[model samples]
Target: MIEETPQEVQVVEGVLLAHGIEPRTHWFEASTATALEAAAALGVDVGAIANSLVFRLDEEVIMIIASGAHRVDTHLLGEWLGGIVTRASADMVRRSTGQVVGGVSPVGHPERLRTLVDVSLGAYERVWVSAGHPHAVFPTTFEELLRLTGGTAALVARD
Candidate 1:
């Protein structure tokens, strides 16, 4: 675990403490979609990575905390959101969500962005999320993330 803590560490820590969980912080080298890279870097299971994905819902941006094992069904989400859902570009991601692709955290945005969680993530007892920095990550439970993000848990993935 890296002790320097991330710039967005405050948001994660605040949310965790509000929920009565004192989580331990960990940092990694490369932050990417390849959960294996993060896992190998952190020496944890690939399943533990919580990939913070952002999509354009209509003109608004929406965030989805999905398990590393599943891919988001953007078309389904678009239908649910009643608009065209598309994968946000890197510029769109930072502009709308105030975070980067791999280092996007479930919280600490400029404001609350409408968010959701993959129901499949509930299968995990704990998950790792980006800590507002590409080199930082931290652990939290699936339930905690849903509550913290104020996001509804739904089937956002499919085979």
Candidate 2:
């Protein structure tokens, strides 16, 4: 079994520590790029995985931390944000967050992008977030997530 944390994850750890949170990076042999994969790898519910989805609206980058169990309703999100939202491209994801799509963290970016935390994620006592790597994840709470990203809690996904 191989175990190595990616440099992006290390950067995320530094950001977490700087914010006074102890970071614990967990790497699995199985791929954790998707909610199903990550949940299976960690033996946790899919909803407990926070998917950091990036959307592009003109010049603005919107990072939506959505529950893995649901899909983000772009229409609703756009209405809530009062801006049109489009799926971000791979290049845009890397350029904006300094990380790839599957491993984008809620924090530790080249710049702070606008973030929204899904209210559904708050149902879980502990949630897992990407640690800047496809095979890396870290534990965090809903409140901590909001604090870290200064994200507004909203119904980002349709029920």
Candidate 3:
């Protein structure tokens, strides 16, 4: 069972509420670092995991919400956005997202960052995304994610 709301959970709750989303956390025993492991532990499909990835595009901050079953096509994304897309360094991630690699959430960031949601995830009725903490996740519909984030739905990841 999860606590009512931990300190780290507060920000996530706030973000979800502000977005008019119904978010709840599910606790698990597996490491939240990788989708494959998380999926196995949770007994959920890999596609249900919405990975929060940070990428640097022309030195600007960009967030990508991709399906666990896929990997981002940075080169294609670069061409689509007219800029080079590369993985953000750990320092850049900390400075921009205020969360580590495995537990980055698309919302409640330290500051606002550009966002992109993978269109492939739209096929699912709902998707699971990490909260601010590893082992914590919440469910959100694809439409809600897109609306809340004001993110473009794109084929940014390869399935």
Top model by TM-score, which number? 2
C-alpha-based local distance difference test score of model 3: 0.83
Tens-digit per-residue lDDT, 29-95, candidate 1: 4654356667778777776788888888877878888778778888887777788888889998887
Q: Candidate 3, after superposition: displacement of residue 133 in Å?
A: 0.9
- Pairs with steric clashes in candidate 1: none
Query: Residue 72, candidate 3: how far off, in angstroms?
Result: 0.5
What is candidate 2's local distance difference test score?
Answer: 0.91
RMSD, every candidate, angstroms:
2.5, 1.2, 1.9
CA shift at 131, candidate 3, in angstroms?
A: 0.5
Q: Work out the TM-score per prediction.
A: 0.84, 0.96, 0.91
Model 2 residue 76 CA deviation in Å: 0.5
Q: Output the worst ten-in-a-row residue range by lDDT, candidate 3.
A: 1-10
Minimum summed lDDT over a 10-residue window in model 1 is located at: 25-34
Residue 49 in model 2: lDDT: 97
Q: Name the lDDT value of residue 103 in candidate 2.
A: 88
TM-score: which is higher, 1 or 3?
Answer: 3
